[model samples]
Target: MKKRTPKPLVAKKLIQPIPEKVEPIQTEKIENVYPLNQMIEKIKTDIGHSPDVIIRELKIGSKRVFDAAAVFIDGLANKDVIQKVLQNLLVDVRETELCEQAEITDLIKNFSLATGELQVLSDTPIDFNQLYDAVMSGDTILLFDGSPVAFKIGSKGWESRGIEEPSSEQNVRGPKDGFTENIRTNTALIRRRIIDKNLVFEPIKIGKRSKTEMTITYIKDLANEKIVNEVRERLSKIEIDAILESGYVESMIQDETYSPFPTVYNTERPDAVVGGLYEGRIAILVDGTPFVLVVPALFIHFMQSSEDYYQRADISTLIRLLRVGTFLLSLLTPAAYIAVTTFHQEMLPTTLLISLTAQREGVPFPAFIEALFMEVTFEILREAGIRMPRAVGAAISIVGALVLGQAAVEAGLVSATMVIVVSLTAISSFVTPKFNLAISVRMVRFIFMGLAASFGLFGIIIGLLVLIAHLCSLRSFGVPYLLPFAPFVLKDQKDGIIRLSLWSMTTRPKLIGGQDNVREKTAKPSP
Candidate 1:
């Protein structure tokens, strides 16, 4: 009976309940903060008794209005700075206008606080947030206990290496001051060289977690806007957990992630980064890393050093050619050996071929096997040598080289020729200025060696084609990785592979795909 009654009456309409419009809770603003003392007390309370943010009360004469305190990070701020600024504020500040009270800053600097020098307003002008930021950043903060605002005077005294010649990129003649981890010092070092108002240092904060301070140094009219935009865009696109060093930024902003070639080049020389800026490219400097990043970097740039331009053109040209040759050798030597021994034996002269065969006669493995074994062993030893203490690294490298080669040859594990080939390959990889570039080449060298072993000359061709295709596809800040070449720009060719006479390179590279194409107006050739 109950079921029959329900069936006759129940008509259910599907209805969803709408969420009630809750009035947004408004945050209450501080209607009126206490006078300096009360506000300071409130700040102290909020600080929850942190050791670094200290408050000390000191009396000045009979007025007793002069209450001052210092705020700074424990390690970042110097005691001498705190003592100097505080001492100056208390006793040195002269009342220039004869107003009993004067602004705090005038006294500390060349002038004492004048009558009109310091004025208090209902609205605090000096950014407390910014001042606190500077304080946290190794700066000293002077808070006049009575004043609503605090003055943050920079007292960042950090210990770093004296300007020394870059060990990585040694030069014969030039400023020996390589960049240090201190950004201000590095910027100052660069500014010392470029006595121009156009040299602007634009700072940007990056890294969501690291919050690393990065600077974009560029000449006003010299740097192309398109490239600048590209650089900024790529950097903005970087979403990472941290950027501890310049390498982290380099990895994030490179043109091609998978390509063996490097799209962004790094240097320790301030002149080099400045030179890149002059060329209308963007340069990035990270706070903790001395290495600076240069974008729109071309393949030819790595073959060059700051010393190259400093030296005679002829000598520089020769050295640059040697570098290029070394790069080729490093990437191809092991592969060439495998190719010749496996299938291209006719390419070698009869005597050399006979000598190689003689060494290989007792070897149990094929040429590919021998080369791979030697190459891997050398890579392991090289890595260990690098990781070991510097004092013993050289010794380890020497011993490792000798033992790996001699033992392998004697054991019939690898041919003596293979040992020589792999060893030469390892040495040649260092010709590139950047260690990252050299590392990438080292990795690809093995791939080419593998290809060569499988199909000899054919394998080498395929491997090179793959590399070229990948490079051509890569773009660094919108510039092609194989730029000014591969695509074959005849005008920009003057600067690639070989550096031409100064006048000959009057025109800037186009495939750099920059907004500005001219390095100079009329072709004034370098004699």
Candidate 2:
């Protein structure tokens, strides 16, 4: 008999398209010719009667020949300046004998309005979207009865937190000022340090519903054009309906989505962002978020701090070495412990092995299980400390850790040595300068523990090899993640794991600093 033919498997159900109701945005097209009353009604209809949107109607010219209106968000626009503009326009218009729309505009431009930033929209009705955005962003809009264009007066003023020292990126010698939730203030913080003509802040709006503002800051001659364009393109391609913070943009533009490491670096310190910009990097500033993102971040950047450059070269180098050491300890300590006690007991000294064995004699679980339990408990304590209120967070974290560790050891649930190992690992993890990288290390540690539990030190060796290969394979906006060290550029080593004197460091990172790598050629100080 002939072999029966196999039947093709049919899908159980057909995939259906998502149902959506998309209304046309009224602001997309120009409003047809309408009288002043109709325009005012249209504005009201477009943006509901929110108590904050102030619309004040007033008569213009001494004879009251023209009816005019001013519209702005209540708290966002500067009331003092808006009142002054109205006063100057109304009182000064009496002196001009012109009634034509063009004549009135010329008079306003030449003498009527006292404001230095008076802009004419056009002789035709503008799109409601443009009008809405300008008003919402704190600018005052003026509409006249006969004129086709509206006047946009610059009067952006609102309460914002003043500059203060960043809690995350602290330093003893660097500037104390940090980026604020306000995008303008954040850009000004960077501008204060980089006072050059080449410094450019390119603005873009993201989010359909939120209409959030963002700026791409970079030095024209210093930054590589390819990196800048790549950054811009990635940001523009984001089609999300809301971008609340820099993290949203960071996650969207990252090179490796699945990797544990962060490709985009974020910091609250202006000095840090400026330092990155000097090295041919671009900064992304998001409105309403204090943290700003720097692009093409290197793996070493997570280990180095802005304070490193401020300290003496010798001290900086020593501290950098210590951090690197701690990073290795944090990542490998638990796995090494599990591997050694479980599969390589001979590698330990006789006295230490006996002591460890004695400590584990009363413990119920194996070394790997003991270590895993402690690490997870420590992570829970850490998360609780962060989520809890500042007033009680510290006390709770400290007492909880002490109580839990003491109770677990006494209960024979975990060994004392395992507790100490877990504590040391937690302490070492905090040494990383970048919080994102620290999180990545925390996640990767669990994987390493599992590998060590299964295949001993050989499993850990395999894990490290795979980890190194992944790091080498990762790129941050076309720049190698493990740059300078992986590729081994000799000149760039001046500021790698160990930094040399600032004067000796004449050029920026070779890969980042396009054609103009030389930062300073003749500025090396000598005795």
Candidate 3:
């Protein structure tokens, strides 16, 4: 279903008295507008030498006309298109003459040199608001003297990176084309996926000031009507000037804005967004971002990837299990080590405990200090690895982690066992598909680590309880964040922790605010 905004928002109404009559949007005013010429001059003054806008004066019928021009940032309006368009206009004026009965209609309709048109639009009215949209979209406006309406010619041109494999999502097999910063191209990608007429995308200009177009796509009959309304309402509530990325949308409309766990899921894969829409979720495509946002999100979404379904079901199940295992390991492994070593040494094998004690013989710090130091160092190295250039990322990660571990043990600043545990935790944190969820798990890991370091096993258990409670109480666009688990939906569990064969998994996850229920039909039932 196509939505004018993102997924639905939580329903909560507040009663407040309405204010007095507010001024309507000034979409057609040249009166108060910073003149096109003035704005261009200011842009040149503010931005060094090059900017997107251009101005040209050309003679027509022995009179020179002053026109304002603009193209998107590095967009399609280059020298070639501009030259072809202008030269054609200068030479072909005699041919564009209207017939006695045809009047202005033929001139307007057939005036386009390219797939679009180029004509004298000399009627109606224009405001700054309308001009703002034209400017952002890279249309050149011709405002003639003594005319109320300005002509907005569609001649957008610029260069952008072709749709290629998304860096964040690399599939072993599937289409490689991912979304780009261009909103139209992204919409086209989705349109190619769902040829069904029901797959709708409503473009909404958000950013009260910047007016960036945010495309909201959904399957009409599949998505819940109530949820769609909620999404539109939330998007309309935004009061910012500009939105550069989907993360901006996230921070603005997220259900739990302060929480580390993301309420909405994001992906760079068209297949993922298509899958989401098929399952009745909404996909929000921002104008200048490749990170397409999907919702209403669940806790389990972060643990999944489209590859799971693409691969054999058995492999997919194993992958899911690994993610869950890593989730636990990333959160509790280092803490578990600290707890056992500090308060429950008897639990460890005698030889193992003795070996660990022997290794820590000359170390000045206790078990907690050693674990904390290694964990902190490992995190720093992980950050450095990510920030480094792509070519050096692997080398930095391997060398920084391995060298740190070896040096810490050799220096007796940390025990060999502690280094191994921290290393394992760091390794496990990278297993999940969703970076947001992984970071959330990493953040919670420190809290558990601190607890285990202070009060041993008991504290770790308490920390787990608190974490679970918070997750259980959470919501995503009004749907329970930890649904199926907290609500105990037996039917939904088939597709939750394990991969039920595609044949068996025939329903969407309940209460995601989706409209569609069926996912498949019985293919050939065995008697």
What is the Cα-based lDDT of residue 45 in candidate 1?
Answer: 57
Candidate 2 Cα outliers beyond 4 Å, as residue runs: 1-31, 98-102, 123-125, 522-524
lDDT of the candidates, in the order given: 0.71, 0.86, 0.73
Error of 3 at 271 (Å): 0.6
Give the candidates in order of lDDT, highest first.
2, 3, 1
**Model 3 lDDT-worst window of ten:** 7-16
lDDT of 2 by residue, 306-360 (tens): 9999999999999999999999999999999999999999999999999999999
Off by over 4 Å in 1: 1-32, 35-56, 93-132, 144-147, 239-242, 346-351, 511-527
Q: List the residue pairs that clash in candidate 2.
A: none
Expressed as tens digits, the lDDT of each residue in 380-421 for candidate 1 is 888898899999998998998998788877888888777777
Q: Count the clashes in each prediction.
A: 3, 0, 17
As a whole number from 0 to 100, the lDDT of residue 324 in candidate 3 is 98
> Model 1 compared with the native: what TM-score?
0.83
| Candidate 1 Cα lDDT to native | 0.71
lDDT of 3 at 277: 91
Tens-digit lDDT track for model 3 on 398-510?
A: 99888878987888788888877887888898887888888998888888888998999999999988888889878877778887788888888877878877888878877
Candidate 2 TM-score over all chains jointly: 0.93
